[model samples]
Each structure stands twice: as structure tokens, then as C-alpha cells.
Target: MLTRRTTHTTLALAASLSLAGALAGCAAEAEDSAATPPQPTTDASSSGAGDGSTDTLAGDAGTEYSDGTYTAEGSYQSPAGQENITLEVTLAGGTVTEVSLTSDATNPSSKQYQGQFISALEGAVVGKNLDEISIDKLAGSSLTSIGFTEALDSIKSEARA
Candidate 1:
């Protein structure tokens, strides 16, 4: 019942439609990919924002270690009340690499004091031998040193290799 001319026409139309459909799909994918913005990647060691100072993780400053990370807690009584502090330290090649300190100071004045202590600690503890670290007063926060020492003592024990 079909004529040769009709059959040839139908085949040609079908092939053209299929090709067009595939090209459209590819064009849509390309558009979607172009519309998305590329995300920026950051290096861990790279410094950014605020005076080019690198903000790195803390390290423990006392006695040689097997080169790893360690944490210890410290506390002491101030005029305000009992103050709690936590320290995380990093050791590399048997030397203190960094020291990170956190405090549980609730009082407003204590908060200020703790901030000062931490700032002072960077200069005093960083790159020093853990066994040689004996900070007496940091940024006028002399009272907290006892607690800090206590925590260091524990860190030494825990980090013993």
C-alpha cells in the first residue's frame, strides 16, 4: 500500500529529527556548564586577611615528643573565681611547633585577661622546647600560669614516647 517515494521521504525526516534532538541535548549541557561559576580553592598554608599573618594550629611546648598533636586542660582561681583553660599543642621533630589555648572565662574582665594571655603565649611558647617553656606572666595574666603549667605537665606525661 506504501509508495517508494513516501517511504524514502519518511526515512529522511526521521533521521534528520534524531540528529537534531541529539545536538539540542548537547547544546543544553554546554549551556548549563557555562552558567555555573567556578569555585576557588584555598591552600591550608596560605595566609589570607588581616596583615598576612598565618593562623595555624597550636603546638605543645615541653619535652620532646614522637611528633603528634596533643591536648591538656588547666585551671586556677582568680579574684573572679575558678578559671578553666584548655590547650592543644603540636610537636614536630621533638620540638614544640605551636600552642592553641582556649579558656572558660565567664567574667568580662577574665575574658580580657585570657585574650591577653593567649597573645603573649604565642611569643613565649612557639618554637621553644617543651621542657624549657616556663611562662610566668603573659599579658598581665600572671595568675593563670599555674593552671597552664599544670596542663603542660599532663601533656608531657600524655605525649611521652
Candidate 2:
């Protein structure tokens, strides 16, 4: 009888440990997902503004733009859903002197990719001619570039001299 009790107790303890381990693992996974969600992957072939539409650029060749700051909001459909970003850009001599991007992404994956895009935006755009900027991908976030290009198109129209 004592051996039977001991065996039952051992099995109960093993089951309890397994349950506890599974719960702990689930909590850890939830925490990890909340803290560093996965970035939304984008296909490279369809990621860029490859339509060759130059009319959205800063007017025309040797076009002089009014040196000032402009803001615009752009939206794109991601795998998560609709995501939007707002850009504030300062242009001088048709060159992007300073730029800032604010994201309105509710989905975790979209937010992660937008954050990645923001982290790498300035280095890629700053001090570059606004007309020459053609961002295909930055910080492994290709979808965000579509919104950025849309915003930039608006800025170009608003900042044209």
C-alpha cells in the first residue's frame, strides 16, 4: 500500500510540474510577443514605387522648392490591415534636411515594422535631394516605404517653389 501511494504521488507531482512549466512558458511567450513582436514580411518585387511616375517629384528638373517644413499623412494596407504614417520634413534647396515619421499602427506586427522604419529613416533621407529619394526598403521594413513615398509625394507638392 505504501509503494502504491508513493507511485501515485510521484505521478501527481510530475503532472503538476508539467502544468506549471507549460503555464510559465505561455506567459513568457506572451511577454516576448508583446515586447518584440514579429515584423511583417513584404515581397520585394511589389514593395517599391516602381511605376516610374516622376510627376510627383519636386516639380521638374532643376526645380527650386521653397525652403520650409511640410507635413503629410500617408496610409497603406499591410498584411495586418490598414496602417498609416505621418511625416514632417524640412527641405532646403529641394534636399531633405530633417525628417520625422510618426506611425499610427494598431497591429503589433505593423507597429514593429513601423518602428524599424522610423529608426532607419533619417539616415536614408536626411541630406539627400528630395527628388532623388526612392526608398525601396529600410530597416527590413518594405511596406512602410510605400506610406513614406506617399507622404513624400504630398510634401513635394506642398513645398514646390
Candidate 3:
């Protein structure tokens, strides 16, 4: 009787050990299933880097005209309406090399304002590469400044195409 009891106790212990090992294996598999999969990286070489020579015209205002020498266009409404800006962008080597600005409000009273706006735009984009030209809001003239920057962005898009 003592031998039989000892054998039964040993068999029970062995069974419990086997059950614990199986549970551990199942838990490990569950943990692996919960882990996130690796994400693929983007390849910049395959993506086309824009040459940045197209024109971006925003607002309900602004027009773009193309001449043989250069693209001539203006973005504006009436003098009393929303501000309009014209940007004459010169491109060479698939980049914006020069930017000229014109505005509809050019009277003696507002001439200085318009001139200052144009000067600010020209200064902002004169020698910068098309990819590097980004204009946030200008200090004094936000509207005209945004319009000018949009025009340059547009031009850069066209050049890329």
C-alpha cells in the first residue's frame, strides 16, 4: 500500500509539471501575437524631389500669364477689394532665380505701402532655391506676403512637372 501511494503521488507531480510547461508555451505565443509588426521605411531616392519652379496661385484672386521671355501674371481684385499680387518669377536650371512683385494699389497715398510690400517679397525670395523658398507671414503685410509666397510655390510646382 505504501508503494502504491508513493507511485500515485509521483505521477500527479509529473502531470502538473507537464501542464505548467504547456501553459508557459501558450503564454509566450500570446505575447508574440500582441507585439506590433515592423513598418516599412520610405525611399527618398524613388520619390521625386521637386525642382520648385511652378506657380501656386491661392485665393479667389491672381492670374498667371506666360510670355516667351518670362511668366507674367498678377493676383489681385479691385483696389477696394481683396489685395491682389503679381509675381514675375524667372527660372533657370529648374529653380527660381528671381521674383518680381506688383500690386493693384499703386497710388501716391498707398504707393509706399505697395513698394514696401514688393521690396519685402523680393528680399524674401531673391537668391533662394525653389525648394528652400518658404514664406511665413511677413511682419507688416501678411496678405501680400502670403500671396507672393503662394505664387512662388505654384511656379515651383510647374517646374517640377
**Top model number, lDDT:** 2
* Best model per TM-score: 2
Two-way lDDT contest, 1 vs 2, winner:
2
Kindly list the per-residue Cα lDDT of model 2 for residues 1-161, writing each as its tens digit: 56988999999999999999999999999998999978755444553565643332233456668999999999888998888999999988888899999997889999999999999999999998887888989999999999999998899888777
lDDT string for model 1 (56-130, tens) is 323434334678888999999889999999988898766678888999898999899889999888788888777
Cα lDDT of model 3 by residue, 47-108, tens digit: 45555343333221233323212443435343445555667777655445676777666555
Using all chains and alpha carbons, the TM-scores for the candidates as numbered come to: 0.59, 0.63, 0.46
Backbone atom clashes (below 3 Å) for every candidate: 12, 0, 16
Query: Judged by lDDT against the true structure, how good is candidate 3?
Result: 0.59
Error of 1 at 7 (Å): 99
List candidate 2 stretches off by more than 4 Å: 1-61
Each model's lDDT comes to 0.82, 0.87, 0.59
